[model samples]
Target: MSGPVWAPPEPGAVDVHTHVVPPATSFVERLTATDPRWARLVRRADRDDVADVVVAGRLFRTVRRVAYDLDQRHAEQAARGLAGQVLSAMPELFATWAPAAEAADYCRAFNEWLAEQVVGYDGFYCGLGIVPLQDPAVAPELLAEIGRLGLLGVEIPCATPDAPLHDRRFDEFFTEAERLGLLVFMHSVGSVTEFDHAMAGTGAIFPARIGEALAGLIANGVLARHPGLRLLASHGGGGLPASVARLDFVRGMAPPTRESMPEPAATYARRIWFDPLVFDAAVLCLLIELVGTDRLVLGSDYPFLPVDPAELLRDPRLPDGLVDQVRSENPRRLLADAPGTKHEE
Candidate 1:
């Protein structure tokens, strides 16, 4: 068989789903020394080269240098043909179960650290600040600070302890994000306890959780109400495209679903953006068929092996133009449209 048609990426192509961590020693020292409240809530296991962060009793192990080492990350980006990497705090750092004020402080520190990491790497690095969604009222102020710090947008989880993202309490935050043109990069890392049992063995259930979260957002009219919101769903939108037929079937048969959702799930799915991390040619083709080329962007889940866009781009099934769009044009478009971003012509 012939090799896949290839196309060079445009300058400044972006990887939208990478993560960053605060310097382990400094983060632990700052919280422990300055704030007793946060000190009690966080724990650390420090090794020579890496640290394991335990927040609210959940362990995130072995955060490596690639998470915060700019030289290493830049070298990796250069090797992978990425012009920029969009950085968000690792999802475990959210700590939404803490008291609202404490959560805000934790999120603030993470955001500040992210801002510092992105400094001097203007065109090659863009940071997505974290917000304390447990306190919805505080989100707007934090988002404004993110913009002030020259970060690109905000990264939020699919669900919090209190509610899924569609709940009315989050309406103000979503509205502000839409009004400001912020890119709402929705990611999931199994924060919900019920999912712990359901997702117990293999990690398969994590992506499914993302699908459920997207379903809630669309069914409850969040996407409809805020059309301008630039939402990007992680992990190939978590079974969303594959489930559309079933969802549409439910839309026709279920009275409550029909009443709540004016359009089919596939209609709303098309409105949102997704990363090309599905890792299969057939599945990627299905995603493009369902969501269209314009809505898909390259994502590597960087510093993590197994989800490589390079392999996906190598699939002979993809057209050259479609490959080009996923690698460059689409991501550039997403960034250019983000609120408070200074798009260079």
Candidate 2:
């Protein structure tokens, strides 16, 4: 909200939000017939560049070579002038509805596979592992293993199984993540079944759900308690930057909200990281105004949305030197500050 105050640095950018679907062969081999609501690769008879991901006996979505082919991804990155990417699992693979044990197994296999990919690719990729939030008891163990596997953090949906993100059920998991200094990437899975029509087609529900989840987290005091936990909200933190004023107004009139929040909701939001994927330069400027430049990182939602990071940084509306921070320095700060890494700052 204030004018950009910090000086910028170099131009190399690190994307903090990118999704990957493991190779279909590996996905099938890891799951047995009894696995719950698993994803299966369906090769199209006619196309070499595309594949459909089938989950629970229905087509989930279509993906391209960029989703699994690192070589192709690298080529795209070179053309776009990106330095690297932080990889997260496809949102559909979350499968939070599955039984806790089964979900944990799926996550383990995925994390192991991701770790292998990160190791093989070395500097090109940073991985965020999945945890079974449906089963809170097993989540801490999974979080621990994610660290052991050399992942910088864990990726979780905006909400858990029985409760929203602010619920007490996830306290232990957040505590452990904070203790371990892991980053928590909050992504939306478009699973709000109540709004079937909205969530079913066009996938417009993701941004709305992301916003609701963020509001829930703030209203429920999760940020207040786990101040040290590093959190990243995808899709420009949904509508949070624009809704801060409304939230502040409501907080003043709402006693429950006031009691739960010791500071302005916008203040807590300012501490969280957000990716600049809103697709509008004006919106991006507002986001920086609301949360400050340091909170933003270059996240293109690569292979899904063909975002041009250089174009965004080159926007004439932005303040001097701000591009350098969002394009490179901010992401480097995030990685350096993550737990279990020698790059602590």
Candidate 3:
């Protein structure tokens, strides 16, 4: 811990999982005018450097300038020997509970703002915008717009308040995403509109929900239908590693499951990608064993999780060459073919 535990990988590495929030003042007026949901949430603060994020008149989290400051983020990543980061809006911004049109407008504006920020960072950051999945009809058009806006992909909730990732309502969006070869980054929310009131904010819902979403995607044949799609799950795919075997066993006993998946649960699991931000070396090893080395990448839920990423990567228990793969090679390869705006100076 005295010095950098792991040397920066050659050419530096790309962090595929990170988050950002636009300054509330940027859209608070339009949002508060139409959507009380947002009005009660992201009000403007007196200073740009700090703001309290309120939800339903309660403080959610305090955000700071680093959340959107390009120069500071660049220098911070550089200190860790990272060449760039893929920036996505925080999960709360998904706003699946809002009216479809309002959500779409917010997503479009946020994406445009994010794309502009990415361009301003030159090659230091890559943009992963959001789409209004609450309205399946509009989501695909916005997804195509994401590509045009020079963003690498879209970050979506692992499951909407009312629908799972494989719900047929969204098949069109996923279809267009595959056809366009865009990355689909799925993150789990700690609380959503549909969860039981008693279970809200218990903190266990996030990872468990990711596991459920993965199972739904596999069992309902989303991956089978969109073979070319690239999905990167946040938090190392939640509880999938420990439960995959049980899933395989259940699929074997259930004819419907077999009919949909055609392969073992693990087969479909391997087809998806995961970020190694599980916060434990043993868990990281389990994920590698489940999906192999090629599918793993660096994910520091940065600005929230304060641990030094290099220290996490330096664990001796990790397999030889695994550090370099996760820290440097894997993310670069995954993003190398992205159609987003070039980061080259």
* lDDT leader: 2
lDDT of 2 by residue, 1-345 (tens): 111111112247888899998876554555636663677667789997988777766666788978987778777775767777888998877888888877888898888888777654436677899998999889988888888877889999887667787888889998999999899999976653354442264257677778888887788888888889899998888777656787788889887787667789898898899988777789888888888889888887777765576577678887778777887888988877765444313
| Regions more than 4 Å wrong, model 3 | 1-10, 33-36, 39-49, 192-202, 341-345
Cα lDDT of all candidates, in order?
Answer: 0.73, 0.78, 0.77
Q: In model 2, how large is the Cα lDDT of residue 274?
A: 90
TM-score of each: 0.84, 0.87, 0.88
Q: Give the candidate order by descending lDDT.
A: 2, 3, 1
Which residue ranges in model 1 land beyond 4 Å of their true spot?
Answer: 1-12, 25-27, 30-59, 191-202, 254-259
Count the clashes in each prediction. 1, 2, 0
Q: What lDDT would candidate 1 get against the real structure?
A: 0.73
Q: After superposition, how far is residue 323 of candidate 1 from its true place, in Å?
A: 2.7
TM-score-based ranking:
3, 2, 1
**lDDT per residue, candidate 1, 1-345, as tens digits?**
111111223495678889876665565566656543232222234554445544434443455567667778788677767777888777766666667886787777777767767755535777788899989899877887777666778999888878899998999999888877778889876644444542352266567878888988887888878878889999888777767788788888887776667887878898899998877888888888888889988787876544567678778897667767887788888887664455444
Model 3: which residue pairs collide? none
TM-score leader: 3
